[model samples]
Target: MSVDLETVRRVAHLARIKVGDDEAVRLQDELNAILGFVEQLNEVDVDGVAPMTAAVDASLRRRVDEVTDGGNPERVLANAPAADDGFFVVPKVVE
Candidate 1:
């Protein structure tokens, strides 16, 4: 995945960023170096490695699923710009 100056310019344009000709050349070299590093990483043998969400060995703690009151109605409605009873009040859109 070698990147040329023209390809770098096109990428910058697609990203809606301004880049000079010199900067484009520099970015092309940088992108090619990154691709080279990724290629090198692909050569490593990890055939038996298991996919993991976290690097730590600790197991995630979870709680039993149960339904309960979300919060006290008075607390929830406290910051409402306009509230009637326990519900938020909004302008009537339809008659």
Candidate 2:
């Protein structure tokens, strides 16, 4: 649960980030603070509470699903650099 400088360095390497020695030390401090906050959160009681998506209660609005031809293939393909037989043309890489 505790983050050290070596762990922070490993995290930076995994994320493809370039962290200097000073930045790594700063990140180690920040990670320790975040872990401390999480530890504080673990002490709270929430036995009977239901999980909620939002504070207010309201049903999410939805639209009916229907299928139709988007109706303009020629218009859609008009800007293509290279198109053939109603499809975008790309160079074949595989034999």
Candidate 3:
């Protein structure tokens, strides 16, 4: 598909972008060139090629899942503006 000046104007309006006549014409040419490149890409054959996220093989390191109370509450609350009973205190917002 190709883009015309009118199509460029409509796209700009849809995207809430303000494009004057000169800018619209430039955008039209650019969009047409991009679509032409996509058309060329469609001619390539990739019947057996596998989709990949990256060019290199990669894997994530795994860790065992464990749960326990945070060992140090006093250290965690050290920077609180107001703390009580090992918890950060905040002004109540609801009655």
Candidate with best lDDT: 2
Q: Write the per-residue lDDT of candidate 1 for residues 1-95, one digit (tens) a residue.
A: 68878888888999999999888888888999988888886778889997787988898898778876687999999999999989999999899
Model 1: pairs clashing at backbone N, Cα or C within 3 Å: none
After superposing candidate 1, which stretches have Cα over 4 Å from the reference?
44-95
lDDT of residue 54 for candidate 3:
79
How does model 1 fare in lDDT? 0.88
Compared with the true structure, what per-residue lDDT tens digits does model 3 show for residues 14-73? 999999989998889999988998898777798898877877777877777876557898
Worst 10 residues of 3 by lDDT: 60-69
Question: If scored against the real structure, what TM-score would every candidate get?
Answer: 0.44, 0.49, 0.45
Which model, 1 or 2, shows the larger TM-score?
A: 2
Better of 1 and 2 by lDDT: 2
Give per-model CA RMSD.
9.2, 6.7, 10.1
Whichever of 2 and 3 has more lDDT, that candidate is 2
Please provide, for model 2 over 1-95, each residue's C-alpha lDDT reduced to its tens digit, 9 standing for 90 to 100. Answer: 88989999999999999999999999999999989878987777989988888888888888778865587889889999999889988999789
Instruction: Name the runs in model 3 displaced over 4 angstroms.
Output: 44-95
